[model samples]
Target: MDGTIAATSKTDARGKQKDKSPRLRKRSGFVFILPWFIGFLCFTAGPMLFSLVMSFMNWDYMQNMTFVGFANYVKAFTQDPFFFPSIRRTLHFTAFAVPIQVVLGILIANLFNKKLKGKKVFRALVYLPCVLSGAIYGLVWNNMLNTDFGVFNYFIQALGGEKVEWLADPKITIWALIMTAIWAAGMPMILFLGAMQNIPDHYYEAAEIDGAGGFRQFFSITLPMITPTILFVIILQLISSFTVMAQVLALTGGGPAKATYLYSLLVYENAFKYMKMGYASALSWIMFLIVMGITIVLFLSSRKWVYYEEKGGNI
Candidate 1:
């Protein structure tokens, strides 16, 4: 009886130690991430919470805040004339730019995947534009697309075509911006190339063995396999497109007639240029909601289209 009791005590102590081991490890893990947690709370969550509160007030930096409680939001929706136009312009740019970027990225990535001569050089050249500073990109394009004495206009004139105002004409300015966006498809192209290379060679070989042609194999195998990367790129590009301000600021400065005033640019103008802090905060929250809604819709829609290899099915 004494021996049995001693053994039972030892076992219980061992079990207790085992239980404490996990708790200790968890505490250590939390300690390791404590700095990041504190940073997020102080810098990210704190500011967002403050912004939410500010959105309800009527405050300029020079005066005490007045608690308006949704007045700013109401004004933005019903009173502000530029609000809707900015939203529309942002949406217009996003709609035109994201799809073209995705398609071009995929096409270029496919070209890079091919075992062709000087492919490395071509790949590097394609990726070069993505590294250019946005301000520089905008300035360069501004000069190149100028109506008179621009490189593009010179080429058009040489080809016996009329000089077109690429940036000045409101009708074509957005299109020109879209063209500029397409040039920076290098990031997505590289992602797609990585995804393509990860696909097993046997799959292509099997498709060929089954009498499948190149295009058929690409559509049926390559596209479906790379759908996850496509979804990721689409979400990122969508967010970036909506928040685009630097290029517009550097190139058009909200345009000749405010035709290129994106939502983010409008926010910037209100925040800094006009010093309407409360109103800008409200606008930012509205833009946040819009972005969240669109992202949620995309995620929900992706369930039918995005294929997950680990899950062995579409997600």
Candidate 2:
């Protein structure tokens, strides 16, 4: 009986030690993550907290900060007419750019997914615009769309039409910018292509066997299967479009009565050029809130559209 009790106690101790081993492993993992945690606190979290604090105060780099307590926000919403206009312009850009990119991405991805010779070269060529710098792309497009001595205008002239000041005319400038933005749809197209390739061949084969036509199969199977990736791309594009500064800066510089004055441009002008650091911080926080709110709304709405292969199985 004494020997059995001793063995049982030893087994219990061994079991406890096994449990303690995982705890030790967890502690070591945390130790390994400590540097990254510290860096995040110093770089990301610290700057974000500093910005929040600064936003509530009146501070220029040259002077001491004085707490004004939401006055900057009030001014942004009420007194600054530029703020609302910037928001409207940003939303307009996002609304146009996101859907256009997503639909075009899907179209291009579907086309590329087909078996063809020189497919690899075609893919690379299509993706080239995405790899090029945004500023360079904008400059190139701006030259192309120029009223005089431009290829587009030359074509228009050949077709018996007058030159259009694509960038200078507020009515038509947004369309010109949209054309520039669409060239970078190559990235999202690549993403959609990747998602498309991951889809099993069995689904298509099964659909074919069921006598489903090409369009029907695409609508019923291909689209639903790809919905999650599409949703992700749309959200990313929307966020990116909101902060699109480089293209507008290089191409139009918010041209023709500030029609293209994005919120980021306004923030840049305030913080750097005007030395309104507090006001800029306030603007940044408001923009952050707007993005977060939109993201939340998308997430909530995605339940109706986004598909998971594991759950309910359809879009």
Candidate 3:
């Protein structure tokens, strides 16, 4: 009778353990990934799949998708003269704007990270440009940069220089765009500030004790400590840079002889303005491939320069 009771108790215990295991594991997994899973399906995965399907069909929102196989893609390469030019313009913008932003953001972030008087107010001032609407920002800058009466040109003239049409001339127009885009570097600046603050002061103190000057300490200690943040910011900037359409739309509009017609603008024009949905999708897919390839290359090459504090927590 005692043996029977013991057997029964063991069986019940095993059953309870089995039930609890699945429940605990399931709840943990759900808790860990609910947000990401929802975001991926709703925002990332769904859009990607939908775009993929749209790329194969010539749809204009008025008619059914007419399957054209590879014609749209072929035309983008072979028939479109604007395609290469737009790509070149985009590359130019990315190359020029990204480094400038990164350097400026880092500098500003480091500055704000230090204990200074009214630092919060200064940081807020720096970040003000990020909250403004693109069109509004464009209009404001347009008025401020106007050749005949804009405030900037007026100041330049007052400082013994001629007024320059910032947006009309090709050479100056691209530079104007670069300047405007750099203003939005405030967010990255804030991000860098946070990363810098998170870094322990012990590293800098140790470097100083070892006879390191400010520049040396910055290069050796500060840079390596914040490399992960740099890598993350660069990746995000690369992806975002490819889609630099809003500023171009408001400021340049492909401008004096199609100099600043970025790929995104080109895609938008073809897709919506001209009803060339299939061709637009092809352009978008090409952009996707370029971005993906660059990202993969960066990931593979990150071992050379990306210094991580821990072994496996790469951003």
* Top candidate when judged by lDDT against the true structure: 1
| Top-TM-score structure, candidate number | 1
RMSD to truth, every model:
6.9, 7.1, 6.7
Better of 2 and 3 by TM-score: 2
Off by over 4 Å in 3: 1-18, 21-43
**What TM-score would you give candidate 1 relative to the actual structure?**
0.90
Off by over 4 Å in 2: 1-24, 311-315
Ranking by TM-score: 1, 2, 3
Q: Considering lDDT, where higher is better, how would the candidates rank from best to worst?
A: 1, 2, 3
lDDT of each: 0.87, 0.86, 0.82
- Tell me the tens digit of each residue's lDDT in model 2 across 157-181: 9999999889788878877777677
Better of 1 and 2 by lDDT: 1
Better of 2 and 3 by lDDT: 2
- Model 1 agreement with the true structure over 156-249: per-residue lDDT tens digits: 9999999998888888887788888988798889999999999999999999999999799889999999998998999899989988877878
